[model samples]
Target: MSFYNMVQSEKPATLLEIWEAISTAFTHNQNEQFQITDPRHGDFTVHIEQYADFSVMNNIYQPRQETLHIPIRPQVPSLLMSFCLSGKPGLSGDRWEASYEANQALFNVFPARNSTYVLPANTQHEDLVIKLEMHTPFLEEFTSDSDDQLSNLLYKATIHEESLHSLQGNLTIDQTASEILAGIQKCPYTGKLREVYMESQVKLLLVHQLSVVHRLQHSNKPDTTAKLTKADQEKLQELKLYLESHFLEDHSLQSLTKQFGLNLFKLKYGFKTLFNTSVMKFIDDKKLQYAHLLLQQENVTVFQVADTLHYGHYNNFSAAYKRKFGYSPQLLRKG
Candidate 1:
């Protein structure tokens, strides 16, 4: 019942060939809708669709009783964008361990090393992954210098492979990204139209993710006033998690500085650097997102939801909700 079969094969020549090779490496089950044929790999479901310059792989995998690690060596350099819709997968490289959780995403610029993907035991994992091979050189043609984070990252990975190794980082997917991913999944176009739709979405997603990287890079520029140490980065991340869990609680810079033993300047700059948003904006986003969910699912009154989220004034809560979601809470409730 385990789906951790390992298969060793030659590197695939083309993107389509890579998909075919992956399909051929896994076992097929009668009850499963998707299966790869290579018997050494365990049974799993994967749907591969190819476009002009990119390919998408929708994967749902579950290792029966033990964790499964698969080594993938791509013949050509590529940029991979993986969106974790559900489940958690472990990724290990030279000295790092990355766990992709639900609603999170990762962008990787691949070098010439073998990449390992670990699927946890007895748990269903689902991911929407798109791979853009670097052989085409289309990205540079399309992207301008001002908005060239993706292209720049790809160029560095190609020309300076030793210095770069493999560039991998986790990205925080906000509400807009979640909606865009959902739109891609529920695309209604058919035939060539579907391909066009998906290709456009892939580009948009890339741009959005790259913009995040751009912000981080800009914030981390060599400015003495904005620089943060490794410990400061960790402290900022910890504070971010704390705010996420206690979004409804009142917070201020002075209180957070005292609570976390961080200086005011570091508290403010480090937060914006790491999250690409000010602390208050981040808190408001989380609170409004939770309120939106409660309105849609819990059958609660707008007033009740606002009260629970610590919005003392109903009108203020409605205004904030409108600003965030483009509609009033009452309208959402009615709809």
Candidate 2:
């Protein structure tokens, strides 16, 4: 049987209850730790931590040529933010379907409904997921202290505003977001200090995500500028994946325009609209990501890594790497 099938006996009323049910279903090694190894699912490790009003679940799922589905029936109004560091996970509702890919974030508000989270086959999934139950008192307090329009929209959605159908959107993870997530994952503190650090980082992630939504809303207004069709958006997304996969290749605006069969204006605006980043910056981020991985995981020198990624000068590569990750390649390699 699949992991979800083993644990689908009861409906969980809260996030904590959900974790408890899952723990009961799986072999618990320690507090907040659950593991299940199946032939179909490969291996799964779930760590859930509960705060006063929220919960954070860190999941690492590796599937072997099979898909896994977990059904959730949330019993309260809650906001969910899922940060995808790798792999693609699909979320399907009664009427909608959303896919979150690597280096992207998704936010959605649920109103005590049934939904299914699908982990696609043949991939390793690493995700940091946060669930915040929206009580009336907390929502009021949060809105009163904030001037951001996106926060206001969230408040209205939680209270069931007629103007908004659902609070759901996807955002590209920029440098600031990447750093905050990295801090959360690689916390250097322990005990109470670690808890405090996690709380602050979660709050910061919320702030940054809300800001991205606000900026996207303002930039894509009806009367503001060019509007891309669904097809155009898909094409741009394809281009983004291509760039990520070929980060070491040399690319220029003219080359991209001709290769993608898109005009300069549409290419620039469409990419920015869909990914929330310029083409060149996106490529740079991808390259730095690969460089960091090579330095940490592979047995390679800094100079060789730089050369492989097509850095014309070693100094230039070192400077860009330091700027992106706040440390020199030598330091990262040393560790």
Best by lDDT: 2
Residues 125-228 of candidate 2: C-alpha lDDT, one tens digit per residue? 88887777777554565566457686686677667722232224456666578788889878899889987888788788877777766666666454112255
User: In candidate 1, which residue pairs get closer than 3 Å at backbone N, Cα or C atoms, i.e. clash?
Assistant: 5-42, 24-38, 25-38, 26-36
Which residue segments of model 1 deviate by more than 4 Å? 1-33, 36-43, 93-97, 143-154, 161-169, 220-335
What is the C-alpha lDDT profile of model 1 across 130-190, one tens digit per residue?
Answer: 7776656555554446455666755655455432222344565555676678888889999
Model 1: worst 10 consecutive residues (lDDT sum): 24-33
Clashes of each: 4, 0
Best by TM-score: 2
- lDDT of candidates 1 onward, in order: 0.67, 0.70
Instruction: Name the lDDT value of residue 260 in candidate 1.
Output: 87
